[model samples]
Target: MTFPYDRARLDALVADVDARLATVEETARAASRVRMRSPGLGAADLAAISRFANSPDAPRELKDLARRVDAGELSWRDVASGRAADDEGVQRALRTGVPDLRRAYAAIREGEDPEDVVEAGRPRVVGDDEDGPSRFTEDAW
Candidate 1:
């Protein structure tokens, strides 16, 4: 059965999915020092996942689960509580999305060169260092 989409409902779903993705991020980072170089990469991946979750193409099961939450049939936190004792619908949603998110996060974090990502305190050259520069070298007469 289909249910009307609500923004708050979708946001809750997105936040739950994002939290699940966070476990993948933290595990990956802790597993390897190299993966930690791009600090904001996890946030970017989570944003992408949120977009995916809200999109029409997101798994129908996820929508149904969200509908249940919105309808007050289930508490949203139960969805990603990470305990086997949680409701089956919540576990199903977690199982459905975690692997895919893990793969996406891996690709996102591994595919980019860390140096290319913007970071604080990194050095940047403002102008040419050659001595023959025309603009700064010439004095106004």
Candidate 2:
């Protein structure tokens, strides 16, 4: 899938922070990697992010934050860098409009059900229902 930010914009943003071209591309790839981890985001969901990131109607603050992130002025945990995690720019982006954008694009949290995540590492008997007792279970008596 294509990256949400265009090469030109990414280049320009990185230039503002005096970062290299490879850094911007790496950052964009990291953004894509993060987006891919969202449960409901398919190709269409990614397209929506791309459209919003590139569109004029998108919030200016969000756009600027994204640019700063691309420029390496901000830190995103999903993206590897020497910068501190949870920087103000990253926090603001996550708090202000990023979740709304994800919701608007229908990016569900990971797992079929929220509880599924908690149980992810546990082993379950075959044919056992999640909401019902296991076949091997009986009265403790």
Candidate 3:
């Protein structure tokens, strides 16, 4: 499948999907920050950030970033580093996964960079404490 790298299309999709995945920051605030912070990043980076920010085993950077967004110390756009993980397999999948989206039974498959592959179309935040800002959730949901 030939993957189209339309920056505007990818950006719009990422922006919308990313906002839906965020539990703490509102859509407008998050979009502004993510856009401003990730000026040079590609759609894959935004996709990864959206996934990373909500993963159970999210990176420290992502966790901190989420908190900053919740606290209004930073915007989601501000956390966008445009720094996609250097995993070609995941990058390729992210670049062209939509073609085989139906067969996407496993995201971040073997040989894929755990950090680079994103669970696209997801709207849940596993890392966000929607109840408050404490970096980690202490209460059972």
Candidate 4:
């Protein structure tokens, strides 16, 4: 049976699936790291099983893939709670991050040395301009 699609519903679904995929990718990466950097987890000592899954990036295929994955235990609840849980979880994370940004900004406002102020004050994911990428970022802020 085909399920209905709504903006909020789809956004939430995509976010949930994104989170699940990220978790799986994390597990895979950790296993790989332990194999390479640690002991016991040899190159071949990875998980017993692995499979491909589709995503919103491949919308037409994602619903089907999600249905199949939901047949399992851990993923089953994620499927059921997909929309609401993802929506609230994302909202909460973003809501919490704002305070961190504000605190950093506040600290920057109190700096004696302008350069040191911006350097130790705030962290940004994407810097302002990439023209001179190596140039000190404090010049931008």
Candidate 5:
């Protein structure tokens, strides 16, 4: 003889599945929050970097670094955390481009204009010397 359908058992199974699904969702959300709390680049950080990368005054090295990040060849978190400094490209960017990038990022975080921050960080062009182009402070380089 065939067994009859058990409505009560089916309802219990459905409720169990629902509970499991809710638990999984909550775990995923908590994990996401934890990740955000960790030291890393956020959405605003990426946006600020992108803007600096696209700016007319941005150096080629910085643009290359930013492009690597956009293409997933480089991790923004690693870059921000200084873990990517071993790379040659990163080394070059760090000399000038990275400092400006940091300034821009900080400015954005502080609710200031990133463009102005980047511009202000740039080495001012002093009077041109007969020897060559204008001189800049050693720190600027």
Candidate 6:
């Protein structure tokens, strides 16, 4: 019995997979760096941002911000802190009635800088108010 597979085709497929894997690894590294710089965001938040950034319908400023984050030139914190507010694409998105874009703009306007709240010794909570009593406080009795 003779095998029907072509060696060249298999080699090309392997090369393509290797390239894709490299791209994925790089993207993960970049995402990790972004998360480190912006502690307020969770994995789900990052995934939503990634999806929006990759969308062709996304504003150009948003895409540029994502690129800058990936390139280590800027962090998601920077963008959240109104870094891209004045960019043309952002302005256009705001003017054209994109609800999500408006929400993003609002976030930029209202977002607090993570670096400002994070202290050397204090632990920062990512979500919810930990200042309130714990849920188990009454149950422990």
TM-scores, all models, native as reference = 0.32, 0.31, 0.24, 0.22, 0.42, 0.32
lDDT to native, each model: 0.56, 0.50, 0.49, 0.44, 0.72, 0.58
Pairs in clash, predicted candidate 5:
none
Q: Candidate order by lDDT, highest to lowest? A: 5, 6, 1, 2, 3, 4
Q: Write the per-residue lDDT of candidate 2 for residues 45-117, one digit (tens) a residue.
A: 4444445545676566557655765676643333222144356654554566554434433424542332343
Tell me the tens digit of each residue's lDDT in model 6 across 101-129.
45544443355442232222133333456
Q: For residues 1-141, what per-residue lDDT tens digits would candidate 3 score against the true structure? A: 987799899999999987777844676677775532212444665465556556776555556555555676644444333233343332443344334332332343333333333334433445564565435332334
Residue pairs in collision within model 4 = none
Mind giving the per-residue lDDT tens digits that candidate 4 earns over 1-141? 987779898899999999999999999988886523222222221121112224333233334434445554234334223343454432443344446435543453443333443356444445566555554434376
Clash counts for all predictions: 0, 0, 7, 0, 0, 0
Model 4 worst lDDT window (10 residues): 41-50
Please give, for residues 14-109, the per-residue lDDT of candidate 1 as tens digits: 999999999999988888865444343444543443454556876876666667766877544443333333677766666676765455445445
lDDT of 5 by residue, 1-141 (tens): 987989999999999999999999999999886632334456675577677776886788888888888898887678776789799888887787555567666665565654566467667667655554576753654
Off by over 4 Å in 1: 1-54, 83-85, 102-141
Candidate with best lDDT = 5
Segments in model 5 whose C-alpha atoms lie over 4 Å from true places: 1-41, 97-141
lDDT for model 4, please.
0.44
Instruction: Score residue 13 of candidate 6 by CA lDDT.
Output: 100
